[model samples]
Target: MSKSIEAVKRKGKAKEATIESKDQRWHCRNRITLVFGSNDVEELETYTYEDGKLNFKTVDFHQAKSKAIEEILDNCIDEYYRGHVTEIHCELSEDGKSVMVEDNGIGFPIEKVPQVYSEFRTGSKFKDEETDEKGFLHRTLGQNGLGAAATCLTSDEFKVRVRHYNSKKEQTYTFIDGALKVKKTKPKPFKGHSGVRVELKLSKEVYKNDVVDEELLRKRIIDLAYNNPGLTFYFNKEKYHYKKGLLELAQRVDPDTAQEFGASAYIYEAKNTKGKKVKGKIDLSVALNLSKKSEEREKFISFVNSTPTFDGGFHHDRVRRLFVNSIKDKLARNAKKEKLTLVDNDILTGITFTIGVTMPNPRFESQTKRKLVRDTHLEKGIEELMNKNIDKFLRKNKEYLEVVMERAKSRNRFQELKDASKKARKQKKQRVEKLLDANERKKRELCTLFICEGDSAIGGLRSARDKLYQGGIALKGKPMNVAQAAISDILNNQEFSDIMASIGLIIGVEADVSKLRYSKVVFLADSDVDGGHINTLLTNFFYQFWPELFDQEAICIAKAPLFEVITDKGTKYIETPDELETFRETTKLKIKEIQRNKGLGEMSPEAWKHVLSRESFTIISASDVSRAKEMLNVCFGKDTSLRKELLMDEDSSSSTSVSVSSTTTSSAKKKASKAPAKKAKAATKKKAKVTKKKATTTGKKKAKKKTTTSSKKKK
Candidate 1:
């Protein structure tokens, strides 16, 4: 034990020789000692543990420096808590190496300054009794005095300047590297005010990073200001002033929380429990709002002695139990009239609470106080006190209470509907499963649900498809226009309900994807305009709520060929005009006949088997679902203007093609109709011209004969 003690001491004050050859140094070897003291400085005792389980762990220097700053700032706050200070001003150096805080409180005794700096344990505020002659027990922070001593010992320099207005004197003490360097005392002819100003810079050798974080320091300053009402805090040229205490803080955290409650926030300060004034009173600030979603959880923030008890203790539990019980009891009496009752979870789901407590001699689990321990007296005291206040508030605001009860009723109704739907879906699915023979197949095999347009289509699929791996659901006529209908309407439709049941899916808010029965769902429809429309309707219905169904290769469209051509070579199936052209150009075979499949009813079972096979079909995939949704909206949405424009453009182009064809046919008919009339007219003109020529020739022949006879007579 002696050797261990010597080793620890040497390590704590290790010289340069023990340090490694590195530019940076670390002084994490110093050990902590617990100190207890009294009003008289001579009776101080230093405590140490000799157990082998002792821990000499080093703390993070950034955090240690922050705690040191907090210790100094907390001392100033203690003065305010004791009714000694009114204002506090904190300033951080631009380089963020040091911090200074000055207050307008009564300064401490100056003669004991050197001893307080050099000694391990020496200070005031240690009393066994509840109160002294002045009735002041000092319920303020830093009652142990270890915090201040540790801060000075860990710093490179600690300076204290005091102005004693009461004594009309001034004093100053300076500590350099844990030693008292200078102490000065002088008379102030006219002392303006009295307070203590402490400025400190942490020792670089003791801390990994000694620079102060300005933003974190500001938040702490503001929080202190908030908790200590009527105390002003100024830092970084900004002022934080809060007079309403926790109520103001709750408002800042969530502003609309109180307003939505249909009443102002409920603020209560405990006066006494069971007609006896408690030593330290607890304060409560509560805000409530009825959640539209019943799944939302309650939120709570708690504090003890202005230090956050992030891990809640007995006080928080007491507050919650009392609050919930108070409301539940009040609602029980009106349950019959309101036709409902509520549990604790239902009542707690809509509340936001902030609790504050101030204790004179508070106990914590550790020196770095992250949590508070049980205080039996405080627990019972706060519960009894809060019960009455909460009861009064609930009774005063019956309207808000009604809203909360109504929400419970709504949630209950919703749960009942969901349960009923689940039951119905299970029963229907069982019935369909029997028909599908779904239990006979292996679970890992590829199973598909084939949705066809009509009973005829289903007949074709049933004969052609492999029944063990394929199931069919035949939609009557066309599927309901899902875009313009509500979910309830769709569910109530017999065809859609049957289709949903066949697929083992529910059609409402509690829809579950994991419960889906089929691995793939393929729409097998006739290759026509009506078939495309039905496919569109089905796609819209599924994409509206369950778009994730398409993430896997589960949903697709399988094509059915429109034309079957028999030729000298063999029979070929064609879906588009280009396919026909390719068949004629590539095969160059003598065509026997062409069979056009107007619908699925025209196809024989063998043809259906040939067409429904995976190789002969084109499966269209939705590459961009968002773009598909946009197109579906324009084509199938309730608004008809956009669809009307598109249809009009298509019709105008089709009408133009019809008009050109009809115009060419009419002109050819007119030309054929005029051919006989033109032939008769030409024949009549030819006859008239020949008759005139014959008449002229006859006259000329008579003249020539008379002239010839006259010439023979003359000869």
Candidate 2:
């Protein structure tokens, strides 16, 4: 038998009981079975209403805790939005365990306080249905009263205090672990103001070792202060006051507006063309961050009934479309005189706006109210209101239109240059493909192209490589690091262009993977620090442009030998430091000379034959694509300060092991301290000099100065 817990609330108490059943099924409030198995299971179900409204039945631990906090916060904000309250204060406990919200709004009736926390779907917001004389709907932030009750059920300790001056009464309720511990009601002094205060600690059973994220909490509180015109919030020894409302909020979020385009604001009390009252009234505030043509910035934030609509549903779409159309229509009338064409992006390149809608009956996509659904009547009314207001605003600010026109023209020119670059790259790719030998063309199915670091490294590879199936592209030096290079820069790079052509695939936004020339594209660099950097740079290049190549197993890192250990039995290859230590401690074979490979050029043709063989190499891959992107950006992005911080962290760490998807070799280390260590150093320098001379004779010009290696080792 399996056990599941169910919550049941009575008149003034909340209770929980565990029921054992052989069926081992979990049912939601709507009697929908969310999960069924032969053992106990934790399941979460969403109850969807007839109108497609969905609410959480049982959420995950973190989500449940967050929902509990949001529920309580929503109740307080709802009262504030109704215009009854002006002041709200929130406090997080010093220990980071509990939080409290207090609002000076019209308090609930003292007699109904017990049922409000103990019952579901029971509250004051659904009492009215009539529209006001001003054409405003009876809209409130919250309709159903399940928020407080849900919080009570999900919390280990919950308490609520209410005072009603009009009724001259006060009530206090407390509950522990979903069960009511106490309830008290009495007459108030009548000299004080009325309000509600709620405090709760999330249940440990549901959420283990989790506390409210303070930064996230701070953002919500600050956003509320900005969205609500007259609301003042105090939390964590700070006071967040917003009197100028959305206009002020816009500037705070996107501060670069002042430097980029000189901001503009258009606030209007929207009215229909006939100057008569519409079905619903709307107050629109648009704060635009008009930028210079070169800048790229786009931000949009919207709300309905003082509650944030994060997904930006009907209202957002309508506003964006109509706003752009209004500008386009005005610009088209003088298109010949201006000598420019306007597109949607022209008017919205650097724009931000906050809209406030008041409707008698609002339709939201979900019970959480994250998105607003379209209603025909509401749409028509908003359209008429916005068209009239936007038209007038444009006429008053003709200079803003001029700036928008310039931006659109700049975008058009930029697009033309991109087209030209694409054509050139396509032609260059064909030229590189023609350079392939007959064997390469015949063995395309099994062909592997190795991208060597420099000319010196390719000679050994060329001598030992299987020419029928294996091709080599010798980069002059470390080619332009594609991690931070632009598309034009990458296309212009001879090395990059050749690699793309050799691989038989276009490397860009319009890349076609189906035309790949090689079954495998490997980065075969030196077994030193410079090689690792080159490997990282090339990986970043493919990851940035042809990310699908990684998914198809077309991109891989060749596991070049770090140290070649000669023992009495045979020569053993070692790839990592950890493995080398274990081999030294466990192996019984008499140790001979250990060669620490400084670069791929240091390896002889015989060693190259062994390393390049199909069985001797391992392919390196990203454990996850997102992590690879983050690592690449941090290490190779233009942010020098961030890179410095990362380098500093590396120096402080004890181990410098890299975590990749997989490795093939068992024992490897860059440093060898066995017999003939002095001979190994001299051998490395002699081999490097010979490789350089051979490369020069073969028409490869060595770099004037050796590139600084951050470290002379690789994993």
Candidate 3:
């Protein structure tokens, strides 16, 4: 503590926390302290960096060092697999702690062994049939074979024995004083499997502190398992826990999902050699944890045939980008941010997917399989050069096209999907500005907002709210209309800003609605014409902005009475007009017309109590926030005029449920719409762009400014 205070006092520039010694260096941010490097690699013991780096007295320099070394080893192993090796095998030791991953498809046949381990001697060539199965000419994760070599150089004793499975020639390698001791293994008949067995022994230099726990490594195996489902990975013969998650995501892409999405999905298959002929279909992988900005996954894994391409030298990255962009083009969801961004965040969100593309002629830039050159065009509208070939291929394959559409149809899975968007904007708004403002207040309880028509109704609701419930009510006047506001403007708006602050939600640019904890969000309105319109507005708000309500089942519409029977005295009570009339006719009670409370405003605060809180009042089911957004098209996504005609006009009618017809017209529209935006592009670039949609009502009201078009998107 004294050291920190002294360090703080000595700090001159606006530098983050830092500590230093002759042998070690450290830095910190958000109270997370990181010890970057250390000279003493031998006496290393236990590590404490996993739970996080805090400025505590017990800083385990060993754990930090071990993690760094493990990362280096991870890269090295990745390289060895891509390096002079063809087959890769990963299996856990009997106890499930120790993991063994080896490959036998190919083995390193290098010239001058010393030259192989040199940092500058990257064995990857642009395209060589001997090293790569195909010309892996695309952006990949394993830029250089340094990954595997780095591991050999760092570990105490990790043996690498490789031999071309078919060639029957073998070589043995081990790290000795940061260098590989290369030798030849005895040639024998193939035994168990044909891959390098990395018997990683923790060196006092890296895992001496026991940082590499077998259980932890197995768990880590589960994470990358999706990338290598083909490779039989076992934690002592136990497959992995990710299978359930992957299968679940894949289930969403099944036929039913396509039917629901209408036309957003496509299961495409094309034999590159056959051009337009039907050969095989290409389905995306289930990498569901990958959000719109999948940079983290992309940076680490772009596999080719179940192999993690750490260097990204192969066409893996290129194929992925093209594939995702193709999907975006169909959906027309990709929109540039500030017109400067090339891709938006939507590419990353909502996709826990892996795309498999095979390349026979691999053209790589380096020894590591980091990039590829092939553009497996969909063969559709975009030229094969413009990813049109792949699109065309998918378009031709109805079976797979239907599958893709099925996955796209998942738009209805979350209730308040619109409220929670594909993008997060937290930096734009001030959190404290939204706290406890006079116009709004919040509670974690089942408190809900009754977005009514006017202030008179607001007054009635506030007074009528159940005194026992921690209900908070606010009058929405000329809301910035999330339908029209920019992310910045939305965060700056009065009510949203207030709600975000008061409710402890990160709003605007900082909004990560998936983390919200609201219990209920009720949209209270009348049963009249305007009442319906108001309902639409509130639903639109939840759908577009407060999506967490839908994902969490918190958004609902209030069914305040359109007609009521109230007694003047003898307990001024509220009963549906039907009950009042029946009582007057059956028994002998004084009958009265007693005008029905036209709107919420007509009722006093006391009357609102009985109407809003009493068990007698029936609450209408409101779409969950995200669900409402998905169902908007099903409900009111079309032009207001069409919805109005369906709801009020007697001439034509449409259903409230979403309907997607697979007719030529609808298919053509779907085909033309594009897959969606490339959320991947948003991460590489700086600016952010999110999903957007149109908000609509049957008629223009006094509260909101009418727009020229009903295509108001709140993405």
Candidate 4:
């Protein structure tokens, strides 16, 4: 450091920095990042469609390298815009170091081919105030004219072939080492479609890698196909063609949930410098795939003029804000009624928007064209499109509105959910005193929770259960009917709190099956009507809060055997009396003993094993939520009359009782005999009066017949 400092201090004179200007090829090769974005590889989170599915992954992306290829493709898209092209083909070489793009279009004049591919600021798309004979401004993708030239200048070898339609002649040019060496073929007569083809290997010195990514290249080509509905694209040999491009892309995300949001072709007139009124058209297409169950943030795959806008700009912002506001406005009244405020995420979450806009002239922030700048015409067109279609979309998707409302409610209850989550985590860590838990510490989905009716039932369950996969928890009595109870009361009840905590359930939050401690919650109660009531009560509790668990077939019932028959061969557990009767009628083995179990606590160890060893339990599910909710309300609501009506209806419809003991029947007869004697005597007198009336009518009829007979004899 001391020697360096002395050398610097002893300097005699300052030398001026040398200055020189470089050619277009050198400038483009050395400063490629400025023209084509980043030359270095970066990790980009994106998705690709492969093998009939969309796969999202982080991929190594080289923006500048990709942009170089895109420049050649953009020319074809611009030609397509002018109605001169229909089909485009792109191919990657075997080594993956070079790519080729060709289009079927009216190729430009043959003489301008070299300059077009070698010089900067040279192309046909520079006019901003000009219009065709139809007085419409040209809609094109390559506006700056530097893209193709820059790509060519930054390539190791750029080969171009052009067949001019009017000239009926073709020529080929090969520019090697950034056009430092050039070779040309003589113009000659040619056959086939008139178009341009470009093949190039990107310069490794500039891009750091020459190899092109096949998946990303194919994705880009497919994106172009989707952006232009009528255009056809061929990547390698596979063809990609779509009529409703953006909508089809949305469908690719989720076929059942995808739909077209809106489409509009807006034409506006503006005055040119010559005072002539020229028209400009903006074609916008939007599609969306919305999921009610997804908690992920919204995603936008947007494009402008057939260019993929990876970094969304004004168009994305405008459309997203408009969509969110429209939903919020539509749900404002409902939110007010529920005392909740609608948020953007409530409307925007779980949505994938595929947006494509093609306009006469589009402006981008950089040469890579990854984002679109603001345009007044585009803004007005989007507003008009949203205004025309948003209400219809809202009207058609009423369930979507309900989901949004639920999201708002969840947001408002965030603190309560947080507290529940904390309590559940604490409970998960602490050992529960009454829980006979499974030995499986990991892979909790393999575990099953047997919610027993009483603590005595837990003894048999613990002894008979598969310790690795089966767990047991006992309730003091019938569980709380959550349909009629407040959430606070449910959480405060020790039995229910333990059940929720043991199963990793949060009351206000939706259940994620992967996060649950047990894959199945099996209600193991008595075989009697009281046990049935307890099962229904527990069903009501789980279904009222986490109906998704029911949808997933996680809520189940393990039938406790009513009759444990000791056969000569082995033991057979029969769940119902009818089943026992059928077994008696059909079984070959002789039954040694038929022991009826009124409750799970009375079951033997062998019977418990028979119940627990079964492959599957009876899944409790509701196909129609509204009907299930109504029935549960009738069964468990605060209204006593509804319960009475339900019970009376069931009693009148059923000729035989489901389960009745001999002792209960005798007690019922005793109560009937103990009714007051006065009332009993009154009932007997009413029956005697009806009998006397019938007897008198019969005697009168006999007397009338005898009178008629005597009169006839006298006559």
Give the winner by lDDT.
4
Instruction: At residue 481, give the lDDT of candidate 1.
Output: 80
lDDT of 1 by residue, 193-264 (tens): 789888888777665466886856876787687678899889976888888776665665545554211212
Query: What TM-score does candidate 3 reach?
Result: 0.37
Candidate 1 is scored at a TM of 0.52
Backbone clashes per model, in order?
0, 6, 137, 0
Q: How would you encode candidate 4's per-residue C-alpha lDDT over 325-420 as one tens digit per residue?
A: 988888888888777888899898899998999898799999988889999999999999989999899888999999999898778667555666
The model with the greatest TM-score is 4
> In model 1, which runs have C-alpha deviations exceeding 4 angstroms?
1-29, 32-63, 117-120, 128-138, 180-190, 259-299, 325-351, 392-501, 504-715
Better by lDDT, candidate 4 or 3: 4
Residue runs of model 4 more than 4 Å from their true location after superposition: 1-11, 419-715
**Candidate 4: residue pairs that collide:** none
Candidate 3 Cα deviation (angstroms), residue 114:
20
Q: Is candidate 1 or candidate 3 better by lDDT?
A: 1
Ranking by TM-score: 4, 1, 2, 3
* Cα deviation of 658, candidate 3, in Å: 18
